[model samples]
Target: MNEILILSEDVANMVAAGEVVERPFNVVKELMENSADAGATRISVVVENGGVGMVRVTDNGRGILPDDLPAALQRFATSKIKNADDVYNVKTFGFRGEALAAISSVSDFSIRSCRKDYDGAEIRIKHGGTPSGVPAPAIEGTTVEVRSLFANVPARLKFFKSFSAEEREIAKFVRFFSVINPNIAIELSINGKNTYTATAGMDMTARAVQVTREKDLVYGESEYEGMKLSFVTSLATVQRYRKDMIIVGVNGRVVKDPSIVQAVVTAYHRMIPDGKFPACAVSLHVDPDKVDVNVHPAKTTVKLLDARDIFSFVHHNIKNRLDDAGHDQGVQMRTPDSTEHITSNSYSRPEPDTKYDHQFATQSYDIASEMEVVEYEHRSSAEIVHIPEQSGAESAVRVVGQLFNTVIVCEKDGEALFIDQHVAHERVLYEKFIREAAMTVPSVVMYEPLLINVGEDELAVAEDSKDVFDKFGYEIESFGGESLKVSRVPTDVLNRDIEAQVKGILADMLEERKDTSVDYRALVMSCKAAVKAGDKLEMHEMRRLVSDLFTTDNPYTCPHGRPIVFKQPEEFFLRKFGR
Candidate 1:
């Protein structure tokens, strides 16, 4: 048997530093959080050499007392909480008191603060040297400067990716902090140059737009039970390529919660392309008692007591806001009355219970008396008419005709619409499958069960996500070690190789937990069932397809993120002809 020894204070702190500060970004995160908790309306962070060389955070918040400045650098010392009971009811960003002690252990650290009507004081420490306080300028805030991070531990410094990489992480964390804490103004300086800043007056929506440099955005808010959620999300038209932009904050503290991320992504589901992600900053305000933020070493992870309720709340709120954005995201189209275009624009948008007679023919009339045709003689046929698909549908809108045997051209109000036939159908069928299946898609039993080979981790995912697979329209079970038994498959996917798709579903489920995600079972089914490009269509077919498309949840894009409808502004034709 081995004997145990109590580690010295320096060694214990260095060990704890590993968990509290993994990289330069983490140091920035901790300091930024402390600034916010200090009630600083204005905070500034300066980083150099990817935070390995230096990090200085200054905030215009309540300054620490001269007496408390020294103790603030010691482990297990925090004024945010006084007793064990205070841990459960923490409302501040920092309560553990481990940040300063852990951070100062591995770096040259110093803190300066001055309360109102008091002399300013500063404390300094360098790799276990004796800490001492000195007189500082009587500033009404706190400034923490850390230099030579991981300098004491060469091993830690060697593991860093690069200076630029570290700088990016610091910048990323500060951005989230600024947006999440909209009431506070935050500034970031990298490599001696100011790079990013957020205004204290700006709300979450404005902050999000400024930070992302994306103008196409929307705002949503909802309060249910005891929880409140506010969001600044990108419109479907905006294309951010990664899910990393979906930032989540709990009770004003930025956190790493997968549940919240999945909910937000699912809310955008078919609205955006599957491979794309929306840039959303979600602020969740809840009672401190309802959440436990002490779960993670760096205080990044949190466990919500009512996680499921919060998920639904976040998902439904974002979903409803997007739904209200309408089919064209506020694009205005007035009824067209131009010469040579179709007439009788008297169609009313259908009511939920209203049924349309698909069998009826479209109305038409001669445009000779309405207006004289401009001699379009100068332009060639190629210049004047591009092939879309054939057009039909209502006299309410003019089906200008088809283009390239693949797209449908139509004029509505003042805009000329280009609709993709294949994507239009895909979007339609996708909505149908989702609506019909509700929670679980109907699976078809196979004559013979398929045997699939999988690793232990995948087998666990297959078993755990059996219900998710069911939602994806599959009935799968464990066939034993390194293998899975699939008895049935979604009716839409019967023709595709069940074995290959099953493996794919498992791999996907493993990435995102099976409990929260569905493999988008209808995606494959809808794609396979949709019309292909180059398929010729009649005028009535184009019109009908367009009509069906406009009525879908999203007419701007298809299920897989392809644009289903595009518009050429009314000015396009005017400028082209020198009219």
Candidate 2:
């Protein structure tokens, strides 16, 4: 082995820059966050050449003290925290203090600030050189300007996409940040052209409307155990094709937590199309210690300590609000041209950024390829008259005949039972699979790994819920961006439409079995593994299916909430025939 050696400060700073500054947009993010942390009420960001030429962030917050100007460029020097404990109780958007050090090491950087007690001062650094300070013009706040980002390290420039892509990222961040921090006025300019301005004093709803470019939003608020969640979402009438519209922020920091995203998708399960998403601006506020913001250097992803509880909180509150909106919409439709029902009350629609299956995730999949999309005909309450079978009664049920080779016809006393063969099998398989689930359930390892294309958002959910999927014997691994490779699957669900089953699992089937884990995998697996509509069954198979169906706790409905068994009494035939 060769002798180990320590890297120089310049080399180390560049290495840290690799993590802290990925692109020009990252430089803008760090500088903008600094302005916010400085208590700036009015902030402006100007970018040129997609922020590769120059990025200037100006703020009217409390300027950096003259004495701390030089120290601010030192690595690990930050006023946000003083001790190790402060890391857990951070209130500021930036605390690591590596941004400036890492940024200045590879770019032409300058910071100018003036406090009320002292005269205005400015600090400038050129590619990690010795910092120079001088008495600058008087100002009440701070201004950080970065030019030729990564100029010293041309290798970093190679990783960036075109200027348009970089500019889009910067614009996306500004729009999301403005929506979350409505109290601050933020201005953005690209290539010297004014993009947009978010004026101060606007509430979150108005700001969201202006930034999101959506209209007629609904507002909702809910608090549970000191945690608070408020949202401005589009009505059920409004929808978009992409999942990019669902912007979520926590404690003033915009993040992309999959748990939170799943909750939002679950809330709008059947309200939107199976392939569309809604536009929503969700703001969640909890104590600082409750969330881990240091998961990544960018701080765009967070790990919630109480993810399950938080999921419930987000889902129930938004679902309840949407339910009320739906109710109000009904009243509005009855009154011709009268628009005071929900529009006057509160919202905008939310479409997920990576909406793949009209559920959660980033990319789209042709769900109709593997499985037939069931189009249940719309029927009124009067048209859908049927009796629900009592869940658990030991009355004997006998298999009479098979209807259309689909439904298993049965008889118990004076009532005729029409049981959907597919759904009945699903119920039976779901209960059995759930009970046998363990750390690594029985699975079928395929010779060739099945590849599935999904959105980033959908992949995120899959990656996050790895444990849940493992119980159902799914071995999913990232096959690069927006694709997943499955080497193993649950034994019963083998050879079935794994793609459709994955979509259903990530889509509407995240119903929690109890207080702990979500059982979405079992529901989807059972549905996929069950017999098809035209799969003819023998008398013995039908009898065994009917016997196994009634033994389940919920024999009347399938795991997907569809009716499994329907009942018709002999009295109905007598009434219709005038007997």
**lDDT winner among the candidates?**
2
lDDT of 2 by residue, 122-233 (tens): 9899998888887888879988899888888988788897786688789888888888888889999999888768898677887767665556466788889979998887
In model 2, state the lDDT of residue 139: 79
Model 1 over residues 1-579: C-alpha lDDT tens digits? Answer: 759989999988899999999998889889888888888999999999989999999999999999888888889999888888888889898798899999999999999998899999999999756897788999899999999998999988878976866776677788888888889988899887887888777878778866665555677787888788888876666544456678899988889999999999888776766876777899999988989988999888999988998999999888776665552332212222211112232322322432222223122222441232223333232322222323634334577778888988887768898888899887876776667644434445666667776544456656666654665556789886457887766554555656656655555444444333323545544554556788788665665576667766787877667788888888999999997
Going through the candidates in order, what is the number of backbone clashes in each? 13, 27
lDDT of each: 0.75, 0.75
The C-alpha stretches of model 1 lying farther than 4 A from their native spots are 327-579
Q: Where does candidate 1 have its weakest 10-residue lDDT segment? A: 332-341
Q: 101, model 2: CA deviation in Å? A: 0.6
Model 1, clash count?
13
Best by TM-score: 2
